[model samples]
Target chain A: MRNSKMASHLSHFTHKTSFFTSNPRRPSPPCMSVVLSTAPTQSYWASIDAQIDAYLNKSIPIRSPESVFEPMHHLTFAAPRTTAASLCVAACEPAIHLMHAAAYTHEHLPLTDRPRPRPGIQHKYNPNIELLTGDGIIPFGLELLARSLDPARSNPDKILRVIVEITRATGSQGMVDGQYQELGLDQLGSEYDVIEYVCKKKEGELHACGAACGAILGGGAEEEIESLRRFGLYAGMVQGIQGKNKAGFMEEKIEKFKELALKELESLQGKKTELISSLVEPSLAAVQIS
Target chain B: MRNSKMASHLSHFTHKTSFFTSNPRRPSPPCMSVVLSTAPTQSYWASIDAQIDAYLNKSIPIRSPESVFEPMHHLTFAAPRTTAASLCVAACEPAIHLMHAAAYTHEHLPLTDRPRPRPGIQHKYNPNIELLTGDGIIPFGLELLARSLDPARSNPDKILRVIVEITRATGSQGMVDGQYQELGLDQLGSEYDVIEYVCKKKEGELHACGAACGAILGGGAEEEIESLRRFGLYAGMVQGIQGKNKAGFMEEKIEKFKELALKELESLQGKKTELISSLVEPSLAAVQIS
Candidate 1:
């Protein structure tokens, strides 16, 4: 469905009603589609949710030690999948990194006082993807995954690639850096040019990283990876400004980033480009300035 | 130098006399050897310090808006080199990941209240190793490094490998996870087996990652990489227990790890093995009961 149409439907909810409901009272059926509207984009979201659930079920088994796995299960299965993860899956990247993305995001949250208990049993199977949400139990969750990764079965090269892209995306260079810059801008106040630069790093960088990670994992060539990265960066730029509701040449800047994203997508080959374009439509559709 | 000899020198110092002096008051010469004792191991440390300083000077330039680079500059230059970085360097790994190690370590500190100002000018030569020290100036540093990496000049595959290893080392599976487990052990009160497991992760994982990264970078075979990683792991376990001054079974555990490390070293070919052994000696030497 068109962004405006979705927005209109969404606007009807009270301020307290989140865009995605977390209410336990709402009965959850076997399929999430029942809760979602018939709109194509909404269906896509449901499918992505299912995909995430399927991946988690297959990959992360319920382990012993309620302290570690419980919090992780809550974070991974219980919580809604991020748009970044959805976009990554939509682009056909391995969903494992999405787990990393979730953990990284959780790490930044202000919550502390995590569950504490020494680990029980030597977990034999270690997964390549480790979850380290520092609040407490989440940290041990990393250990379980590390143990789960069977080196003989896993591809070192692929694991390394995912690690590289995700770290670069989340670490000082990407999301966290952008956050730092945004905070800086808020405090000292800044000119338009400086604001734009900081916003790109603060916001645009993670989106770029996510898109680029998908392309990389999907085994896209250098040009394709670069193209997707640019697309995400530009898309993020437009989204950041729009979300902040900045005035003065905001429209012009958004248009510029939109065009940039379009240009990058046009440079790619085959169904992948089309798939990415469709995935990004909601973000682009957000530009109507209603 | 023998660990006992080194310990004797350290014992001579008053609490006011810091082991690794950060003070500028002491007389300085061109070489760091001036600050260190005449012992052979001390020279190795001096060399590592010089290497760190050199790498920082080459990678992190004196930029304008002194906010970001200054903090980063301080962190990189002032502190002694971590065995992880030194191991990575020894294994012929690219120095860029070292920049990341520094940033990640800095982020966890309690300091906050960073400078507020949008980034100035498109940093002409953005480095590939971006600096994201988010408390204030560090995040911008990630951007600078990201920009600095000229895509045409760098190898994407190698970069990705380094990223993966480093992130894993620091994240939930490696150091952070270990840290979380350590906290849990402290709270819950723990057993020797549990303590050993936790310490392996807490201390050993990052060291293992460092050694493995070096091996990978040095183009060691898969078996070789695994061996070095195992060596680092066992070695770190020994160091972790020793540092905590745990008695009884501690000596046995240290011997086991030391033996494991020695076995791995013996399995490797020629000078590379020698270099790694030399790099690890001081760490192992710290095991001396004196």
Candidate 2:
């Protein structure tokens, strides 16, 4: 009975055209346009958002055990946009978004037995369900990317490379490692280097992964992929630093990273980077607002 | 300091030759000889174990953030053998083992804040670390498989198919779904059909995935892969049922699955069946021992 009800809700959620499709009950687009006034950039971002939503709707098949799928759909679709998914180019957005949603789910898991008072999906569901839902989501994301591989239409090797990139970014050496280090932050102390390293691994690498995947999927040159990867790394660092420290305290460090991010974009001279360039500033504003 | 210690331990663990290489400190091989007494079969199983061990040692590179890697290595290499990994034919063992290890880690997680007293990796680590470790392990497994895709040596298309197979088997409709449904077992009741569906989804699909991957890696024909897949599904269902019910209560059902498992292998009459066919009986003995 419960399964059937959840399945119906899941169908409805997946059928919704886009998260930003003027649903009065839903909150307006959260973080885009905070610093930019360009209409073209806004439309580009909206297009990417719609692409992600459409891909998710088609890919996440409604099946048995709605208990797990329901939470995965809810957590993924209902969450506000992170810089992670928006940074991607081409069809990589949905795959990257799924990966981000998985990471977000695990990152927010309660360290203790007591459930943390958090908003969004975790707040509504029990921790066990959330944990399993996360376990399920990662593979679903990988499946989406794997399914996109076509010998005639796209470079299978590039898709393989993207898989390796995404996995490495999220694996032990990347995001998970950063999260582990955070558990012992007290013992490690508050050195800038330590914080930076952790922040890069936890947050920067994922953003870096998204940007690199975007370039890879977009058929960018090797140099372009590497440049965008660095751009994402620095941009993610700004977000990470802001997240760790108060807005004013890390302004100098944040500015340094923001400049570094723009510097990396210099190599992609002819490419349209207004949307990408706009990704870094919003982090600062978002941190300030919170 | 703690990170350094863990890194040292991780190095020692990864450098070990083989899990079954007669470590006096370790228990002898547990269930390999339970039913089959053939010396050749024992040697075949040993070789597969060594291959998996070699793959792990070579592929799992030692890097920074030892906290997460340490637990991942520990959980993966130190766990007792499951029928899942042993059933694979060729180089897919390591990849499948990693996936199985990830599933095993999630399966044993304590639902409440209070830790469950279990053996192996979880017994040593806190639930939070264990949870994060599981999250890291899945991608590591996928990385191993993706890293194996050398277009010069193997079929990239087949590798992609295997990736889809694995992700699908372990995704929401597979093992995680089984776990989720088990959480509501009271409402689900003890109907044979319900139990069979859950068991097949949880255990059977993974086993099916392993067998199919092995066949795919070996460049077996499509029909051969499908046949081996069915064989694995039936064998895994026997194990699943035995796991849920007492030894005596499900013997009849277990026998039915055992026969079904053997029947699926009928199409591959020319192929060697000794090692594959031997996988089914041990589950019965294993369940009885517990």
Candidate 3:
């Protein structure tokens, strides 16, 4: 469950990563590698979440055949991997993650070749890495993700520019940023149950904002604007189904999702002619540029 | 945390995944992954596992997301991605692993602009992958690791082979094999916690056999044979660490591991003396080979 949870999150990452990996649009290792360490625990299973979160801010354990005793020495390291490389790295992210956990957790037997000595703590262990640990994990992997994806300010501007311009055509306020914010407060089950409530509130604001923006983007064409409104209603209905696991949907989660979807389609079809009329008719112009 | 965990386990699948993603070299993932889907409660988690296993064998939730939603339809088959030239593909062992997981888990938005409908399942309802059933897991990842890494067959075949060469390096009398067997049982924790025990028995046999084989590989020289014995002992001590995790460091376990390491060193030193003797005694009938 905990581990699979990682897979679920990572699977999305792989898709986003594949686009960049095969495209050759960014640096070779686009991933933002973040490594952290923590103290050992009595129950390896229970501490899994803390272990995982440590990838960006603390330490984690890598259980291995030799890990329990005569454990391999901690080999965790943080590095500035390029976004292009990170994406390419994302394709193989699962593998890197395993070694990352291993490199951090194994702590008794240092490889004969390595010369570093830090007892009980996993350090930046890889030779081919340039790592930095800040005051904390405030920025972590997210910092890398943001920087790597920014086209206008890309370090190697052209490569990152292409990555965004090509696959991430969601434009400014679509799924990319929206998704990141959702992940933040969505850790509802652990210590941050409050995050779920906050997320729901934020989501509501986003919906309202989305409706206004869509209408504006459509130039206030009444019918088209209405269609956008219908879509929002429809989305809310669909979302109700998703909210069941949380606290959103009470009775008809699935049914509501269906009803909303159908209603939106019907509403859109009904307003087809009006939308066309709006598309053709123009409001009076205040001044002529010519 | 969840995504990292999944990536961690999946990485253990190795079997030709990008070096950045997986490594059987770190076996923690499989165990961690299972831990995620199952629960500490034991009963509930077990049932969840069964459900997932069933899903693994056959499709469920009759209406799935793939055939129904095809959420990314516009991006997948629309304007920019229309032509085949725009797509890229890869081939590797984990390539199949990836394909299998996708085949089982992927629910539709669009594969090729076709109507694959799921009655209700929205694969991307959450930003993460859904656990169709609580307990289900993909087994191929482990197989991939084994096929790719045949310990019996590495660059220097001696160290490459898993149990075979290692056993042979130990001795023909099976003494070395027994030692490895003890350690194999003590591998990392998992639902299949005791598999290590079985592996340990085999490893013991392998070591004894491996040492004997190693001796043959060495020329018929007393010094070389002694060195091979020492190597086997060192390897055995390293392996014994695995066993300690289970039975723990009982006095016997501590004594055995320590004694074995010392014995290995003793053999190495003996080899050094034999090499010197060979130089002094011209016709010393190369009595031992490592």
In terms of TM-score, the best-performing candidate is 2
| DockQ, cand. 2 | 0.42
On DockQ, the stronger of 2 and 3 is 2
Candidate 2's residue-wise lDDT over A1-290, tens digit each? 12233233233333322212234354222112121323455565676577567657756655545677678887777556667777763345566777778877766766454345445543557667777888888988887777664333446667677888888888787888887777662245666766787889867998899888866765567887799889889988888888875546778989999999988977778554555786775533222210
Ranking by lDDT: 2, 1, 3
Please give, for residues B1-290, the per-residue lDDT of candidate 2 as tens digits. 13233223233333322212234354222111121223455455676577567657656655445666677877787555656776653335566788778777766776554345545534567767777788888887887667664333445667677888888888887888877776663256566666777888877888888877766755567887798889889988888888875546778988999998988876777554555676785433222210
Best candidate per DockQ, number?
2
Task: Give the least accurate 10-residue stretch of model 1 chain A, judged by summed lDDT.
Answer: A121-130
**Whole-model lDDT, model 3:** 0.27
Tens-place lDDT digits, model 1, residues A175-226:
5445545545234455566567666865577567666655654455678678
Residue A146 miss distance in model 2 (angstroms):
0.4
Q: CA shift at B71, candidate 1, in angstroms?
A: 3.1
- How well does candidate 1 score on lDDT at residue A243? 65
lDDT score, residue A89, model 2? 39
Q: Alpha-carbon error at B10 in model 1, in Å? A: 34
Q: Which DockQ values do the candidates obtain, in the order shown?
A: 0.06, 0.42, 0.01
Supply every candidate's count of residue pairs whose N, Cα or C atoms clash at under 3 angstroms: 25, 1, 82
